[model samples]
Target: MATLPVEYLRTTRLFREKIGDVEIISFEVPVHKYFSRNEIPYLATALDVDFRKMENLITDMKYGRVAVEKLWAYRMDADIIRENKKVLLPDLASNPVDGEVDEFEDAKVLKIHVGPLKEYVRVFVRPRQGFREVVVYRKPPHPAFVRYVAYL
Candidate 1:
């Protein structure tokens, strides 16, 4: 398979270190856009969080007041939008649909852990005929979420 480039809105230098005549710079880079064989994209944000906070994140997602049609995450892949699972993001209830739109109320959230340190929150939506199963991983809000919250 061919490699794919990750998407980023921007980048910034974090810090610089110098030793004698050599200097090194550090940058806080965005995570790669991981893709399935079918080209579905997902990005996982690393959070050095405790179990309690992870639980809280899930609880908040289960019962959070989300805005309508807001762009919570940066990458809104075409495959995800086409699946009509875009509602799984903090943005929902406003995306145009053939009929009634799917909201968080119409989905199920599953909390899963891969190892002692890796945990994932996945949301599954109602299945539609002739379409792939809709599964969206609930990640931490993108940096833009706070930066543009007022405008959104």
Candidate 2:
């Protein structure tokens, strides 16, 4: 429910491994921003971890690959508005006039589809005020996409 400004976006390429016929790679995208100490505790509590240890947990990343496993985003409860602060309504002129807007509560979380590789990767920013955690998940690639990426 808190609004934290985004300050940094980073990507760390982790090790790559092949298991049988499958390949797995890991990456960490950290987002750094500013937030109050009170907000930090709430985030820690939500993740069911010690608040006091967050600094080292994020900085040193003691949990290794496991640390990136619990990645998630909270669905926001507000409506998107325009820069003028107007409640800009949906475009009824368009076809398929479904009233509902596909509002993604967590804008920071990104799902990337690498078409050539036929692979999907999930990215999210962990709101730590001064720092946010970015995690990506790579799913198995489709046969066509695999061949496409290989050619690139």
- Candidate 1 lDDT over residue span 1-152, tens digit each: 96653322233334443324433332332222211111111111112234344333333332342211112333334343454222222211122112122245544333433222123234344333432233445343221111011101
State how far residue 42 of model 1 sits from its true place (Å).
9.8
TM-score of each: 0.22, 0.24
Model 2 Cα lDDT, one tens digit per residue, 86-105: 11111112112221112255
Clashing pairs in 2: 31-132, 33-129, 33-130, 34-129, 35-129, 126-133
Q: Write out the backbone clash pairs for model 1.
A: none
The true-versus-predicted C-alpha distance at residue 49 of model 2, in Å, is 30
- The TM-score leader among the candidates is 2
Off by over 4 Å in 2: 1-107, 116-119, 141-152
Candidate RMSDs in order: 18.7, 20.0
